[model samples]
Target: MDHWDEVRMFLAVAEGGTVRAAAEALKVNHATIIRGVGRLEEKLNTKLFEKLATGYRLTDAGSDIVELAGQMATASSQIEARIFGRDQDVSGPLRFTLPISFATDLLMPTLTAFRANYPDIALEILSSGSVVNLGNREADVALRVVVGGASPPENLYGTELCEFHMGFYIARDLACSRSLTPAWLLGANEAVPTDWAPDAGIKMASVPIRFAEMRSQLEAVRAGMGISALPCFLGDADPLLARVPGGPVTHIGDIWLLTHGDTRRTKRVRLLCDDIRSAMQGFAGRLAGRFEGGASEFL
Candidate 1:
């Protein structure tokens, strides 16, 4: 049996979660997929998956195999690229992952220009709230918002993109009708203020509405549900929401461009990173507010 072919079948089954799905993805018959899996299990002398009514489920051993298989696939792709000199065209699949909100509000607008400049490069944007594993090569690049003293993995390389200032924003009507006092806006929790400024002396008459996502928080504020502290890039763009006067200002977070340390020097990786950094720098005013600070530290 061909080991590589068996490995590919294992990966397909692991990804698709069923022999039928794997067969479809591989453009082979289901029997072929089942035989491939059986051959792999016979060679390894261990059951990778358990047959179930719903679908095949990976055993603990299978889970471990999947992780290793993903890494192997990445290495294989890199080897193929090297042999073919695929990087010479600067146009190919560029998979990237970023925070959902950042991708929608910040990056989506400027992606057209990036594509135009490098028409050969096909961009794949994965907007996930969860952190992607760089070591596994889940994504070629990632954009992360980090706080002070945070360190990335030793296998990862990161560059400071920009800093965003945060402040409270409320609907125009809410600002007008309510006292708009910090004390009234902030409820009992001073550690994290809701609609009012954390430092504001006014006490809240009732609990302000809370939202888990930034986009929802912004929407709630727009709907006049309550005030919310948001980054300038997202908040300032909305016409209905206004940055409250005399509001306490805070550091939202620093945006960083990240890639695997080993792949950072790769031609495609470096070019994409440079292009994204340049785009972020150009939009510094709109996204991060006007802050006077050198690129040395988190502003």
Candidate 2:
């Protein structure tokens, strides 16, 4: 097999941690990925990954090779962008990674408008909280919400879109009752706050449901399951929900639009960046949660 094809398979397995996932990404069968990895390992005379019950775990050799492979991928992407993507008429598929909540709640409507404005550009949206590797071409651009002090990778160029605040919210009907300790509906892996104890006059009942996705959390809040900290844009806009009184902003994060430094200047990338900036400006007030009392100060 050619070195490029073998190396591509190896890198996919390393990143995906499973042959099945690599197959899906490459649009090939699982056996093909498995064979490719085996052949590559035989050629190198080294065990690339350690098979485990959970999934494939990379060995030291695999990790070392993956870094080199990633560099190669980045270089290839840069060359392609420079050579074939220079046309002023932008037309191609662009992949963007972002948190699911941001995509579904705030960005989806604007993206439809973007498509209307630029009919030639096709969008592929990848939603995840885990950071995507733009350098590896996993995504061309990213919309990230990071904590106030967190820094993005140096290789990324970013435009700050807005700052957003999170606060406790509950169903509007449940807003009037301070006597009852509402059942908590938590985000996935989230622990109920210890401060929500009887001593604090905010004790919670048993939490029966928790969701990893923000949309599910919002639905639970609207159903009066319990109070949760929601982004002000989502909470304020929902007619069925209301901000829980007396809770200050629970979290603050800045939303950033980011692209790899190498691709930032590509014509298509540049055009999309400008489009996103303009769309974000239209939502600046809502993105910053300006509708909530005193929330504008945080923005």
lDDT of 1: 0.70
lDDT of 1 by residue, 102-158 (tens): 778877766767778788788888898778887898888888877664645534567
* TM-score to true structure, per model: 0.59, 0.64
Clashing pairs in 1: 91-120, 183-201, 183-202, 183-203, 184-202, 184-203, 195-227
Q: Which candidate is the best by lDDT?
A: 2
Q: After superposition, how far is residue 273 of candidate 1 from its true place, in Å?
A: 1.6
Error of 1 at 182 (Å): 11
Flag regions of model 2 displaced more than 4 Å.
Answer: 1-85, 177-181, 194-203, 206-209, 292-299
lDDT, residue 125, model 1:
86
Clashing residue pairs for model 2: none
The residue-by-residue lDDT of candidate 2 on 154-199, one tens digit each, is 4466766787677677776665555666777778877766654322
Top TM-score: which candidate number?
A: 2
lDDT on C-alpha atoms for all candidate structures: 0.70, 0.74
